[model samples]
Target: MAGSAQPSRAQLGSDQSASFRPYVAADQSPAEFTAKAVVIGALFGLLFGASTVYLGLRAGLTVSASIPIAVLAISVLKRLGGSTILENNIVQTIGSAGESVAGGVVFTVPALIFLTPYGPEYFRYFQILMLAAAGGLLGVLMMVPLRRALIVKEHGVLPYPEGAACADVLIAGERGGGLAATVFRGLAVGALWKSLSWILQLFRTAVGYSMARTSFFPNATVDLDISPEYMGVGYVIGPRIAGVMVAGGVLSWMVFLPLLTILGSHMSDPLPPVPASGLRIDQMSAQQIWSAYIRYIGAGAVLAAGIITLVRTLPTI
Candidate 1:
């Protein structure tokens, strides 16, 4: 006690807060959850919700709407008079909710409907609506507790990249100067590039090259999707995570596909779960082999990874 120094009040408070700073102070109340905000958010929700469902059904993947919602909310709210930071956040939250619900429903509900004996005819619109509502409610309930534990308690540990990025956009928009202009400029450039590539057909959106079939490696092909949106996502997620994603793709395309081709080259008969075309493994192209066999493998791997992650986090939950 003689030599030891006691912590100051500021230091104690800082330690308790875990270095997390709020955009709006606790003492201040802002114009959040207004009628206008709700209306705008709902309109955006409907727009994004429909688009996400379409994308998910077509591509079996959905993009997060949080950042886009935030950007749009700030821009729209600013144009229609001015808005508080909290109002923009409220709009973003409401709008992104639709995207989240659509993403979940499209990913699993269609599969359930088609996979059953009755097929899609068995499920009515009301049933689908109820299922989506229940799923959304369940997710919210689950996140209630987890949010406190993961987000509040372990603030610094779990770097929620999407949430952080959205927050940055909101803050920058609130400041309304160079930062806001920078964000809009990037969005404009991306829009122009996408329009040129996709709408005008100025250039190829994706490029692919098929390697010559050799004795050792057959049907080897490499492809790249040089979309502006995807490139923007890679930049946001950082190189390390992007590299891991690229590595997975390379492993699947280069390593797994080649090995499968080599092993199945001698097989005269078609593989089990044969494609609609009913082509033998040896006769099938690289894309056909991927669609028939590799897709299932990838799905199984993803399922296993999800289970493993859930098991590991059970204690924390």
Candidate 2:
């Protein structure tokens, strides 16, 4: 009789309330919040897109400075009391999504510029856009299932320093000007480092510092090294994940670099002498090489790690 009894008014309301509560780290209606997110995201995306394009063109390389820019923008906005901390984060997250999309687009878009010399097709802008969108969607979808396991459950497992720092900024802002000195210090330090580094390089023209051969270190192979980029990556990833990355770096540099150098010398019609401005091993032919190789390997490693993580977290979830 109890099992068959209808629910009371309070019980019904409780169920409705639970159903209506917002999810995804924000407390707002999906349609309304998402609309606001889209507008805010678009503005940030335009800024990031413009900055990236300008910097990339000027530097002759792709430089992803969007994350810091977004963080700085949010921090500045908080000082003005124009938006809440959560709102700023939401806007930043939404806007920063464009960089991910642009990354995928740029990879293939360059083919139009360089590959056209050998082929008929030129500038697959539409194809690149579609691929970029698909990749962006996939990344979002993949990260969705991991958010709870990574962000919610594993509190200290993933340090996520950037997120923590953003939170700290917001909390400090609430207390009024507590973070002003820290912000000023960060900017001053960054500017000083850049200025000093440039000044030191005034007379010396160091050419081989790219993903090619290094002139300073003879026979050195260049890949992504341990730099500020990697350190920031390590900080957000926590020590566990950072260790894995270091392992990857060791594998690529310590093992892979030496092997490539040896094998490259023995092969029939071996690579030409190292270029003055290069830092990577001269092993693969242009036709034999593709960016997808590195991408696929990275995807596989991340997939395997994520799957292992999710399996371990299933019971708790």
Candidate 3:
């Protein structure tokens, strides 16, 4: 193994660094963090933030706004007399920050509003604003330490697909190639598809079919949302994570729901904490059963998973 011609540490590092080059060199300083960039980014942030909140409230999930923001920023800045790659990146970062904050607030704050004895009225605008600000500050503070390690040093070692995609968009815009045109075409197609479903009402946005009740299986159902957004997300996350998500859905719908239905159907009275409606489990639909019981189980499972993950990562932290 001695005469195999292994590269020295310095040579290896140089090779690795040379493999990936930034659109703008490190030594170059550009018109980044400019007043126009900040203003444009803030405007986009507010726009996406509002939309994210609405989407989260409706669907309990939010789409990543980074790519769209980057695309828009590039187009806008080009029309406004051109901008640097770093300026566009700064715009994207600031705009996506709003979506991130909105996502976090919508997911957790609603639960607090519902669960607290003081009720939704207790959470005023100022209180919610403060909560969001604190969460965003904490997140930024935590990432400050890890940014160099995970984002900079690791680089290709960690498959940060979203970040990579965003960077590609910025670079493509800067280079003025077919890649940027393709992105705009995709945007147009997505917009048309959404309009067809939402505005024209040509078809259902979601569809579902409930399986017939049998001796073995009961209250089983399958549902799918026909949305470009979800498809894009699944593609971005890749098949393995998507498969795991599908498996969880199957466990909830096919396994747990049927078992619960079979066991509870024989009972004459309504379940506890559900009020005395005199409706037995057998009378309830799959959706009703899920709302009444299975959601709590799912929530518990998520809590357990989070705790386990935190415990595993605590040493590293």
Candidate 4:
């Protein structure tokens, strides 16, 4: 029964201890927490951080780099030899910090540049760096107290989805295959689609039609992007959540945009931001109006939602 599974008390509790066991044990230590792991992890972290910032600025979303960093660290440490799984874990821990910091800063910092009239010059390097450092330290401090309550006590009661997937990847590689092929297939499909749409420009990356000519629904439009990345995200988050998100988009496009166009059309005066020299709102396309005004409204809504969520969760914290 040595090769058989054992239940984990930390996760499954004493009742299920006979059924599951932790991948890592309490006492069996390996060459972990090393300088080389820290250095290599930092490099991976930096790469992910920069890439995450760019992706977030472009897409208004960011993803955790933990799974990918763990995978890469595992592969590298294995090839280099004389490294333990513990060292690999340490490497990923240090490396993923870059992505975490970048993710936080990019949310606020880039908007100060691109969303403002003054542009990138207004964004100071030292100020942004300090902001990121402060945010990162704050997150670490906050999590330190919760490690036992959430990570240990709750255990399998809650799934750390990204971390679990990364562990699966590591184990799969070591055991010489599992459902990892499915993951590779997904990667191949996504890569191929991106190459066609982005690199080759074989087709429009985003395809949409506007109903501007129709008198019944002026400024009402639908837009869809053939983005593999976004599609994958939607698929992962699942249909219900994706549908809710689509509802928000529908509100912005069908209800809000049309209403704004109608209201603006009746007015003879140019709106301050709309510019006195510019054509009236009737003349402006939905895309133009969205760029000039609607984006701020969307950002405000998101901020409000975040604040409300924080307020609701304060008691639990």
Candidate 4 Cα outliers beyond 4 Å, as residue runs: 1-23, 111-121, 152-161, 164-189, 272-280
Model 1, 1-317: lDDT tens per residue? 79899876445544656766698998999899899899999988888899789766644556788887888888888888989999999898888998899888887777566345475786788888998899889988998988776667656555678899999989988998434455578869988998999899999978997665574556767898887657766776678977876777787778878887887777888878777688887777889888778866766666787799999988655
lDDT assessment of candidate 3: 0.81
lDDT of each: 0.79, 0.52, 0.81, 0.74
Q: How many pairs collide in each candidate, listed in order?
A: 0, 6, 0, 7
lDDT of 1 at 93: 89
lDDT string for model 3 (17-110, tens) is 5587877888999999999999999998999999789777765457789998998899889889999999999999999998899988987777
Q: lDDT tens string, model 4, 57-92?
A: 766777677776777776677667746667767777
Scored by lDDT, model 4 comes in at 0.74
TM-score of 2: 0.47
Candidate 1 local lDDT, residue 74 = 86
